[model samples]
Target: MLISFAMRRILLPVLITTGLAALLMAAACSTAPQPLEKKSEPTFDEGEYGGEPLPGTEQVTIVEPSPGGDRFALIRRRTPGEPSDPRFQLWIVDRDGSNPRLISVNTHDVAWHPSGDRAVVTVAIGIDFYVYTIDLETMETTQWTGKESQRLSFPVVSMAGWFRDGHRLLVFANQKAYQQPFPRGLYVIDTRDSMTTGPLVKLFSTTCLGNQDRYTVGKKYVRSDDPSSGNFARYDFDDESWRWITDFPKDSLRFVQKPVPSPTSDLIIQARETGNAKQLFLMNHRGKDVRQITEFGGDIPVWSSDGSYVTFRRDVHRGEGARYVPFKFNLKTRKAEPLWPVSPDSVPDFPDLSTQTLDKLKPRR
Candidate 1:
């Protein structure tokens, strides 16, 4: 029995050691499968409703917010399923309680010009571009016809301030500026000479090396994709130079919206993150200061006229999963509060609007 016990101990140790060695060899020989490559596609943005109006104050969509002045545009889809065309009508509302007025009776993809003198609008049916100029004093509408091309999905003109001469208009179309799918270049057009009857001339194309397609217009500068840091850049179309404007982290940079250039052109605001952890960055082109005005978790950040405030949509995290909540961020206080009283269940989409024309949208039905 003593001999048997001694033999058993010796055999067990040898067997365990042998088994472990074999397992190690097998693991070393096996190869791990590589992870699948990811698809890079822009996610749809969430929607942010405006603040509560005064007692008996009509509900309006806040378009842009500044220190004391805010511009809001109300848009209503033509009665859904109604006999009338299934298009969105436009209206403009002043921050001060003023009745909304019509801008485009039938138009989508509205783009404002750099001079703030007119808006480039594309109607349903025809792909031609039409300019809608509003008289600030009398509120009269003047329509100008622009050059025809396969119009961009979301086209924007350089703001009045961004141009060196204050007269040139830069239009960016989603028609392959550098590569296919995304906008690759910008077409400069001189609208000051247009009489709405003759053929419009095409200006030189603005090009960027990397997917630097998405951008917003400013005075003598176009704030676009830095692509290097996944942040924003202010491009000088005339001098053919680029300057980095914002310093959003790479992770947050992925979620920033296709920046909305303000009327002044120097300032821009965009969504810089996604889901229930979204944030908005107010950036200045001349200075390197980036302020995080809103920490609301959502997407889409649009700046106001005065560049003091911004409106954006955020998400509300519910532990395991998350829900989207709209919000507004004040730049001065750095307060990011929920804008919506009741959250929206449906996924939101914040379409691009021309600041000049946005003031003219009707409410959605």
Candidate 2:
């Protein structure tokens, strides 16, 4: 089942508006504006927001760690203010909380290449969203998709993950409003084959594992809108088939999301709701040896490079809104702890690269 979280819904609309404004301004100007004599790197004032800050919280969702585990990519958001326009920013930082650099501005989702030399980012350009590959070494970006990915209305494109061979990407696209004839589903794009363009080849209608090309996981829905009758199933890419894995009681309302496999093992972690709230569960590749790993509620679980631990966000309800706190769980010890110590005064410093900096580090074509 595709669970639309509150954060995604809140950020997409705001960023799409900003993208549309940019497009309008570009179209209105007949002549290109003169280049600025001095273009400094973009920077944010530390003390710009001087008053009592808004009650809402800031969060960092870990996308993926580098193959070496020395660096990781994440999306950071600070809501309840105008400066928060463009909703989210993609950041890359060291494991020790050092050398934090802002790679993409106003991007919601990111997927790292297995080689750790580049990352694919999803950003709104106007009424449509597209994916671009950013070179981590030179900080140069290349738009990977074009007219083929566009929809009649709001088209949302998400970078699921890279294929095991790192030659193709698993992408998911759907119109904000469904169109009967238009197709909406998961697809795999050949990263190396530039001649092959347009909406990628649709593989299935639900989510799947990134690196494992052989098997894809999604819900088997009996009805169009109802999920209570659904059961988890795995799709075989080789044979082009799906096999049911789990079937809960029909009377119970169960929802599943983010069924990710461990980096080094056959273990898989997923979130499901069989009770009041969604909780994390651990199971083998075949969906056996099912075990509950979290009780206080968590979602979007990502495994470390070593696959020894999993990190997820825990939602805490405040007065009007909610705050997502990050936590890490150890598989061996079966213990959970706060990912980072709480600091009321701490503010993250996001790195900004100047045009000159990017030009100096531009990758060779």
Candidate 3:
């Protein structure tokens, strides 16, 4: 289940529909054939980013932007027409939806630094997943983890959240390779040392869940979204356990699910069931002043780097088929426009641009 969650995370974010329609659409999307664009080399400049601010929130930072929050999750067969496991071919675009670039192929998971230039990416070799850091400017990939033995190694590593310091990672991994390799749980890894030889400390021993599992990785709590509803809980790293969420404004959120706190941590975007349809909404942290954002579909809504915009998926049905589209909604204007180079008419559609800053979603403590 957790491994499937990791695959879901690579697909980025999307809200599950209710009932049979939801299951059917999910099945359709899962089986839908995606077009494979010609791959491109990295085109980032060295001077594109610098200087970082502290991200907000306790488990996540609502203030600092998450660069990893912007990658579109996708499945691209490295060896076309061959039966194999699903591999991600990630596409990245600017917040305005311009400058679409194929970041990497055959990747597993990704976690970006607050700087929006560097990424901690995971990839599967044969049986185990390896961690690597990508410097967009220099276009270099560095191995972050290695193994000496099967029992003393992390067979699975998914970068879940980052600390405010930006050098520590809240990662999901399993120490040993087993016939059943569901991740052991969450652990802290410091990148201060060379990543390939970093330290690891266990945090919990439950079914380790991350953003890939459709849970919003927060500072004090991990908000897991149920297609039917949502739950807020606190993840106590110090105690190595989790507790129920406290001080939340859940006064009128009886029908909310897939709730994503913005990078600022002041507002949350959620899906509310209404008129037999699920639509997107934006409300305050207190859960007051609720307002509708999407009239129809708001699949996997995520905040942009600066938190001024909300990126969402729009499913367009034409004739007998439907295509999922990516759109950026302006908070100030209260209007949503399609991200550039992608539209309802575009073939094979596009991937999500922003998946939420796991670091930024940490509640302020």
Candidate 4:
């Protein structure tokens, strides 16, 4: 308190210099490089699995061969733009890849009738979560859902598939999509009714239906990730009960997809992630008997009507871009071939499937 003028001046500069040095040191440390921290996956996607959507080409094309295997119902992007449009235009192409006819726009999913002439389509554009049946022969569209467009009957609803009776269509409703408790799962809607409103019965409760869910058989349904982890389970219509097919280990069940039931109704064929390769496997309806069918990469596994073969989609890169082209795999012969070729019609319609499609695939010997 009684310091001299020279002593005070010298001490003040020293204090100021020290404060500046400390601040510089902290700044240098803040800018120094640190190890990168891996971002953690959310619990929903971390331990729990199943219901992984097919990447890339899922936004471009989805080809569903008619039950008769003589025609293909294709939901293809009208144009591969910069952002990649979510809306798809449904087209019908012959088994030989001829006669490509544009069916509908804003088509989310299409489940064909057993006769292959008709399809139940889901239009999920904007407020239009409407499901309808389209007649290919007449090019006529009839709205099945959303008769009372003023309100939503269910928060989450999509056409699963047409039942064997043809008059009934299976619809999947899950409130879990809105982060709400699931009060609905699978139900039946009679196209026999003009408005498709009443008499809709709730079959059971399944919360994990990924976006653009695909359902084929009512007796067999796939699950999305839930509390423990997502495992493929079969729903028994006979017993009106849920049966867990938890034979496989939890990790192996990750990314299991397209559990298409075999024509015999015993074995289920699906594609799953194996190491780095996406391969095919056959499992029992109860989720046992997991046998590896192919070591090559395949996705969207579709079993033939007779169950002798599987048609799948695999990524193919042209000089222009990457495409998920269709390919056929013979189970008995253990051979893989291109399912269909891109038609080079002067017009996009009236396409053709050629053997050269395999050139892009380069099937393994």
- Candidate 3 has an lDDT of 0.43
Error of 3 at 227 (Å): 15
Q: Estimate each model's TM-score.
A: 0.47, 0.66, 0.52, 0.63
* Window of ten residues with lowest summed lDDT in model 1: 195-204
Quote the lDDT for 198 in model 3.
20
List residue ranges in candidate 4 displaced over 4 A: 1-60, 81-86, 126-128, 149-152, 176-182, 194-229, 247-254, 317-321, 341-365
Candidate 4 shows a clash count of 1
Pick the TM-score winner.
2
lDDT (0 to 1) per candidate: 0.38, 0.56, 0.43, 0.51
- Pick the winner on TM-score between candidates 1 and 3: 3
The better candidate by TM-score, 1 or 4, is 4
Ranking by lDDT: 2, 4, 3, 1
Q: In lDDT terms, which candidate is top?
A: 2
RMSD of 2: 17.0
Q: Model 3, stretches more than 4 Å misplaced?
A: 1-87, 94-99, 124-130, 145-152, 174-183, 194-231, 236-258, 271-278, 283-292, 318-320, 341-365
Model 1 lDDT, full chain set: 0.38
Q: Write the per-residue lDDT of candidate 4 for residues 1-365, one digit (tens) a residue.
A: 13345433321211233332232233223333232233442122121222222333333345677878888777765443324432466767778767676667677777787677899877765544566787777766766544434122533556767666677776665334444333345666677764243223243333212111222332222444342344455555545455665434444444355466654345566676543445676555565545555544567666554455667765543223334556777654556666655543111342222211111101111
Error of 3 at 27 (Å): 36
